[model samples]
Target: MLLSLEGLEKRFGGVTAVSDLSMHVRRGSIHGLIGPNGAGKTTIINLLTGLYTADGGAITFDGTSLVGLAPPDIAALGIARTYQNVRLFKGMTALEQVVTGCWLRRGVSLWASFIGLAEARRAKKATEAHAMALLERVGMAGRAHELAETLSYGEQRRIELARALGSDPKLLLLDEPTAGMNASEASAIGHLIRELRGQGLTVLLVEHNMGLVTEFCDTCTVINFGRLLAEGDPHTCLSAPDVQEAYFGRRHDADRIQSLR
Candidate 1:
């Protein structure tokens, strides 16, 4: 496993968001983490990224414990994520937004940059080139100089993805990545994700789009009310009665599930 959570627990005041959840993500594979609304999917992403501390249990990445590490520390260990909602700097260009993501890895001191040192200039130029390449990878190179706030929602989503990739993560956690995209746009993003996996990146995707889940994920884990509900291939897991009930209702709302297909 590339990542594992054992007996994980989280709460907000008296409300339990996640409860005794245990799951594992295999290396270099696209794994789906899914459920209905408020299923604690985003909370798990927060916990993994060190935005929230785990109340109990353990989270291990590779062989190291992630407990108590700060967000930047966790990121330094090669874990990166895209937000559930698109997040981009208002005044920053698409290229600039992505450059910030790799700043920590630049190794050039602020003093050096401020002093206009030749070595710092070289590093800055190299970083910008690399950032441009990432923009190109996400099909946003032509818009590299455009302000992120001015782009379409789907375009902004692509920029956010490129920014996350700037960190060169070993594991990428995507939270509702295709939330506002049209079917065609979402399918394009799916193809990009598959390309990333082919290039040796691991992805843990939290999505409501069952079509993408069924088509792209090699395996999946379903949770309801923060507890594990089902686990296996997407088709089997989605067909389970309990999974259907959790997603729809006791009435089974089969039509709704079918519509996503």
Candidate 2:
């Protein structure tokens, strides 16, 4: 397993965001976390990335204990994620944003970065080359010099993916990576994610696109009301009685969620 969460739990005051959630992500595979709104999907991501501390249980990534670690520390442990909303430095070029991600691998000291040590200076140049390669990998090389703010929403999301890839993560978390994309754009993103898998990167996907989930994810864990509802092959999980009940009606409305298609 590249990632493991065992009996994890989180509470926001009186509201339980995630309760006793547990799952394992096989290395080099795409795992889907699917559910309706407020199912604690992103909360699990936050817990894995160390944005929020788990009240109980354990998170082990690549053989390292991740519970209670800081975000930067978790990131340095080779986990990278993109948000549901596009987040980029408006003033910085796409390449520059990715270069910042490369700093994780470069390991430049604060003093060296401030005083511009010879090694740090060398790393700056190397990072640019690495960043450009990442941009090329995501088919954004032509827009490398463009400000992230100037890009379209889908384009910006691609740049965000490139930025995440710059860190050379062993496991990647994508929160609704195609949230605002059209069908064509969503398909493109799906293809890009498959490309990453071909390159041996493990990915945890949280998207409502059922077509993509069934086709792209080898395994899925479904959640509803902060609890696990089903776990298995994507198609099987999606078809499970409890999962259907979670999304649709027990009275046979026949209004299947389009994402399931």
Candidate 3:
């Protein structure tokens, strides 16, 4: 396993956001985490990224404990994630944003840059190259110099993805990467996800799009009301009576959403 969560629990005052969530992500596999609204899906992502401390549970990455680490520390451990809503450096160019991420991943300390050290200059060049490569990989090379806020919603999502991948994560977490995209745009992201998995990147995807789950994810876990409901291949998991009911308000509504738009 590349990532494992055991008995994970998070509480927001009296409300339990996630309860006893236990799921393991296999190495180099695209693992899907799906649920309807308020299913504690994003809560789990926040826990994994260290944005929120867990009230109870264990999170292990590559055999290293990750329960109480800070956000930056968790990110440094090769776990990168995108938000359910796209987050980007709105004032900076897309390439610059990715370059900033690359610098952190490259371990270019602030002290190294403050003194104008020799290695800092070398690192700058490498960071720029790395950012460009990531932009190209995510089909954003043509808009590398555009300010992130000026891009279309889908374009900004692409830049956010490029920025996350610039970290060269061993395990990537995507929270609705295709949320606002049309079919073609969403399909592009799906294709990019396939490429990432093919290159041996383990992914934890939280998506409403059943098509992408069935297409890219090797296995999926369904959650509802902060509890594990089902786990297996996309079809098997999604077809369960509980999943269909919780997912679609009824069993047959599943057919209406071959994909989510």
Candidate 4:
């Protein structure tokens, strides 16, 4: 396993966000986490990335415990993520925003950066080159010099993905990557995620876009009210009665439900 959650739990006062949840992400596979609103999918990402301290249980990545570590500490361990809500440096150019992610792995010291040391300058140039490649990979190369805030919502999301890729992560956690995208844009992102997996990166996806999940994810886990409801291949898990009741519940469009079957 590349990542494993063991008996994880989290609560907020009287609300339980996630309870006794445990799962494993196979190395180099694309895994999906799906559920209805308030199902604690994002909460699991938070706990795994060190954004929230687990109230119980342990998260192990590559055999190391990840309890109580800070977010940056987790990033440094080769775990990178993009948010459900796009998080880009609004005032920064697209290149600059991605360079921030690349900085995580650069060995340059802060003092050296301030002093414009030769090695630091070289590292910055190398990082920028790598960031440019990632942006190009995601079809955002033309906007590399544009301000991050100026792009369309879908473009900004792509920039966020480019930035996460800049970190050279062993495991990528994506939260609702296609949250507000139209079908065309969502399809593009779905293709991009498949490409990423083909390149040998392990991905854990938290998304409500069943079309994308079923089309791209190698396996999926479903949660309801913060508890594990089902886990298996997307085709089997999504059709399970417990998942259909908790997620679909006759609320989805007929076409959507029919597609699942």
All candidates: TM-score: 0.96, 0.95, 0.93, 0.94
Ten-residue segment with the worst summed lDDT in candidate 1?
250-259
TM-score of 1: 0.96
Candidate 1, residue 28: the lDDT equals 96
RMSD of each: 1.8, 2.0, 2.6, 2.5
- Return the top candidate by lDDT: 1
* Candidate 3 lDDT, 100-200, residue by residue in tens: 77756566678998897888888888889899999999889999988989989988888888888887899999999999888888898998998989988
| Model 2 poorest 10 in a row by lDDT | 251-260
Q: Please report, in order, the local distance difference test score of every candidate based on alpha carbons.
A: 0.93, 0.90, 0.89, 0.91
| TM-score of decoy 3 | 0.93
Steric overlap count per candidate: 0, 1, 0, 0
Which candidate, 1 or 4, has the higher lDDT? 1
Clashing pairs in 1: none
Candidate 2: list runs displaced more than 4 Å: 254-261
TM-score of model 2 vs. true structure = 0.95
Tens digits of per-residue lDDT, candidate 2, 1-261, equal 888888989999999998988888999999999999889999999999989999998999989999889999998889999998988986999999998778787868989978989998888888899999999999999999988899898989999999999889999999999897888999999999999999999999999998889988989999997788888799999888788888786726434454455
